[model samples]
Target: MKLLLYPNCSNGGVTAVIRSRANADKENTYLVVFTNDRGGRHSFDDLDNVTVRIVPDFRLGAFLTYLFNEYVFDSINVFSMPKIVEQMVQRDELAVTYEFHSSNMSIVEKEISQLPLDRVASLVVPSQEMKSKLSERLPKRLLPRLQVVPNLVDEFVFNTNGRSDRLSSLEEGLIPLVWIGRLEASKGAHFVPRVLAQLPENYVAIMIVSLESDPTRFDRFLAECDSMGVAHRCHILMDLQQQTVAEFYRSAAARGGWLISTSLMESFGYAVSEAISCGLRVAAFELPVWSRFEEEPKLVQVDAGSVVQMASAVAGKVS
Candidate 1:
């Protein structure tokens, strides 16, 4: 059997899932990916069995090119694309499977509704909450096709074995706090400075590994940290290698601090789980996605706009 995998969003979870499927299956598989917003090609494309087709950002060109490629494949597996569903629904030989990872169920429902339900052989959702939500929205006949495949980081990349010496040098009474993700408004980078301003001096050493796509916005975040006098406590990691990320995890874990996920909206919260997998605890706001994990005791659910509550939550965990 063969599979044509389309991973539209270049988020880490999407890449990890496709890489897992491609590497595990003995059968022939082709990876059809879009140009990464990030400068580099996918790290996992070293697999000899997989062939990749990178499409341009132009929708019309991508649609035509992707439609042309679909003709050669026996089955289509789309991570997210409304047009792909439309194209494949018209084909007889192609079996369709879609993996839904977006936080917006309404958008997914609207897109999936256009495809012929009979052609859709399977539907994969990252979180059980997302699966349940889709089951509720989908027609009764289509509900049986849904499968819950939770999102997971590559365990090796997130391993916690390398920071023994670095962690040993921590100041006598300071906790370590880490926020790892893109430093953008959606990631709650704005709220982080507010939280830091309210915290006590020398209470914790904060490490921020932000892979910001926009330089202007990245500079703004740095400016906020500097103007607030929180720059000393935080280090903004711009070009983070996977190995360095693992070291950050191990260093923070050894120091007994928590990894904070302050994203206003996270479909599955990959960082939260990465921290958990590293044997570190998390203190995230109560997003429905966060509830899917078994760390509610450590969670501090807050209103979407509650900066004070967010600060209080961080302080509660660190102080």
Candidate 2:
């Protein structure tokens, strides 16, 4: 058996990885998720041949259950939890792999630096940018363990077609600019209204965000939109599935619109890539992770933190 342990399911990216791995090799894969409440919907709970164990409390008993289990796991892939890795290292029989998924390298470095590097079989990161960042912070000897494995978008994204009837409120001449992610400061979602304010009146901004337990932020975003006088042109769609999100991408593409990302940091631009796969144009900040896609005709890299530049790029894409 192969065990994949993540501290929580708060991150969709980690869940994506787990889903991909489970689908690829379901027979031997077992996912051990630490927490259940924080993140959006649990997307991997129904996979066949994959066992999902939710241990809310990360205590010694839980650790003992994993450590002294009858089912022997040949390899264990841990996602960004040094403490978990520390405990798993106690089991001499298991090969532990540390998978890094965040752009917050300082926090990651601080946590990982305390672990016994020699016991780790390998260190996996989602992108080359992450590999380089981790290399700078880690010991020279430990740098050899770093490996880059990019995230995979869900296969359903590629085959989805536009649903013209769904977004009926959008005017015929308007260009739909889609933004997907958590509506938080870190995600740069708060900057969306300012960007939308700069765009042409016909270029509407559609936000498909997870509004779970964060009503204040959502209300504040609406208030900001109203203050900026762009609330009328902005639409918020909540709790959409992967297929529905793909349809939005397709719908935007059909209308000659595109995806816009204002993320301050990204380990890998999964949503951006997915948008591109759906034949939609993308205007995103020129982050290190998107370097490979810079040459793609569908992807437009705007100056980081420049809302005007991002808005202008999206405006240019509008017919």
Candidate 3:
């Protein structure tokens, strides 16, 4: 089937999730991504059975590109746009599926509820927590349409031999704690310094790899780390390839080390899944879905907003 996947401006993990679907069942699928010019840059550039279209920003251009031509699509998969769903309905498209992330559900239900019911096929969410929230807020009319597809780990990520070989290269006598994500305000970079402060001297190094987005916030995080005197033990990695990311996970798993997620919000914890699947331990804020991990001995759960608690959790696991 021809699936037209409409990705709004922000494409991070969502693009990966979509690409995973396309890559999974590549033979029978024709995946077309309708993106604004700004959404063109992404890590999922090498994907096959996927065509990228940069729709124009102007009203006439948008209407002609997205609205008028949408009927050619057999199915429409939308991530983060109520207006696009409205336009799809206007064009008489039969099946349009909405993928929900933590940030967009409120706007989805609040603005797009009046659209013809059957045309909206299903709302795919990553976690039960998000599904619960969607179920609670969805107009009773749209409740039956929500579908939960748990976030999947990209199996291609784990190259066991490559990870094992990389693990051998690391310096001996130090247990590595690897973290990778964006360096931003909401990323809880502030909490990281505090988590490090409570660790014992023997816990060794933290390789905190992040894509540097805002310079001011990045500087603030480093400054706080310096003030805490834990800066010397933290290595800030800037932009590595996906295979290298998998290697980091492998190294940690080899050493029986843990991966930590301090962020306040995540629709689905990508690193948490990658780490746990690689057989490494995990620690995170007791957010809705993350709390579920604590039941597994491999994962350590910490109270949200408590650095000492997170550090203690990690320290206890590592020791």
Top-TM-score candidate index: 2
| List of clashing residue pairs for candidate 2 | none
Q: Score candidate 3 by TM-score against the native.
A: 0.80
Model 1, span 52-165: residue lDDT tens: 656654663456455656546655677766565666566555667877766655668776776666678898888777877888878888888999877657665666665544
Q: In candidate 1, where is summed lDDT lowest over 10 consecutive residues?
A: 1-10
Candidate 3 on 90-207: residue-level lDDT in tens?
5454567877764345455764565454567788788877888778876788778888887666777644455544556556656666666666555576777677778865454455
lDDT of each: 0.65, 0.76, 0.65
User: What residue pairs clash in candidate 1, if any at all?
Assistant: 286-301
List of clashing residue pairs for candidate 3:
none
- TM-score of each model, paired residue for residue: 0.75, 0.88, 0.80
Name the TM-score of candidate 2.
Answer: 0.88
TM-score winner between 1 and 3, please give it: 3
What is candidate 2's lDDT per residue for 1-319, written digit by digit as tens?
Answer: 6677675564355766677666666566564555454443456656665666666654634754645576777777877677767777777877788888876666687768767788898999889998888888777988888999878776644445546345566778998889998876767887788998887788888898874675888888889999999999888887666667778888888888888899989888888988888888999877888887856999888888999888878878432
Rate residue 239 of model 1 by lDDT: 44
